[model samples]
Target: MITKGRVTATLDGDFVVFMIGFRLNKIWAIHKWLPVFLAMPKMLKELNSNKDLGYLHHEIWFGRTLILVQYWRSKEKLLAYAKNKDAQHLPAWKAFNQSIGSEGSVGIWHETYQATRGTYENIYVNMPSFGLGKAGKLQFVGKGQNNAQQRFEKNE
Candidate 1:
């Protein structure tokens, strides 16, 4: 079963926590069908392949929009993957940048959190869901009590 996992920020409140959000608009009209046809298989392969390298969690929404919520051991790992030359991600990114750089056909945006206090999360199993799925199944530990309240509470 493909499951989402809780990702907490652990940078002693220094490194920024990113809620990266992005939508990819297909130009090839024919590519409009790629998500259901080709992308799913590619995504499954990537997810399964990188399951061990601190790949915390992810989800696809609105067909073409992919929202990846991952917890990195550190920001360095995240940057490494973003800048990796050999990984499939880099090629995809480059292609997107080249093909849709001017018109915003493909857009990527991110929100960062400098967690001075703390962050908590949960995961939902056996369901097709997004970031909210993380809030469904979670157990809190010492100083990490009140998972519900924590998840619902607004970030500062």
Candidate 2:
């Protein structure tokens, strides 16, 4: 059994939050889609095992389109992982380019947010751990911390 309640989260210092995922433009093209799907676990496994790479953690959403929200210690660290030749990401990326060159069988995208302390605020009420909640430190909301603005002030 699970209980639901209020839980808030905020991170410390400068950090990078990355949102990346893909969409299946053509549901019938399993060959094209499966490789893209297969590539993620390899990269995620590599990141999860090596914390120094600044891969903090992630939450994923799956559907016709998939989304992954990832936190990192810094932008430099995140870029390093993306560019490192020895890593799983680089190979998988090259394969993606080769196999699916914008033919529209699949679509992929990403957005990155570079943040510093006090730049973001979040709240989770009657919910499980999620988003910045999973990526940041969790704390119970208290007096004057019941809404968005207060959460920013309380977290700061």
Candidate 3:
């Protein structure tokens, strides 16, 4: 359901923010890019099916360049998932390297951030729980939590 008022999100401890995506460089090379594109859903399905994998939640946007923002319980869990041989990620990664291999047909990249209390803050107004809000606890923005600086101070 949609939350009608100002709200904020808080996590108990440290968390991980993983941003991963791909850019379709050569649109005509569907053969080279489509496999790369199709691989993500399989991995996402695997992660979603198993909560213990450390995958909390994810938001995806599609276009010429696709962006996926993923929240993880911890950095160790994220790295472990990436390297897990029995998981979908490892096989898909191997396929990407064998097929695409920096040919410029498809450009894939990722950025990982480690966040802790006092290091990150967020506010949502008249919107449904999203992003960090979905990954963490949602609380109505209180008297001292009306602004970014206040949120930071409160979190600190």
Per-candidate TM-score against the hidden true structure: 0.52, 0.93, 0.97
Stronger candidate by lDDT (2 vs 3): 3
Question: How many residue pairs clash per model?
Answer: 1, 0, 0
Which lDDT tens digits does candidate 3 get at residues 7-65?
99998889999999999999999999999999999999999999999999999999999
Instruction: Give a tens-digit lDDT track for model 1, residues 42-102.
Output: 5446645884443445544554665555444446555676677765566665665665566
| Candidate 2 ranges beyond 4 A from true positions | 1-3
Q: What residue runs in model 1 are displaced by over 4 Å at the alpha carbon?
A: 1-18, 24-44, 63-66, 112-137, 140-156
lDDT of 2 by residue, 1-156 (tens): 212677787787788989999999999999998999999999999999989899988999999999999999999999999999999998888888999987889999999999876677777877777777777877787788888888777656
Q: Which of candidates 1 and 3 is the stronger one according to lDDT? A: 3
lDDT of 1 at 153: 47
Q: Between prediction 1 and prediction 2, which has the larger lDDT?
A: 2
Q: lDDT scores for all predictions?
A: 0.47, 0.87, 0.93
On TM-score, the stronger of 1 and 2 is 2
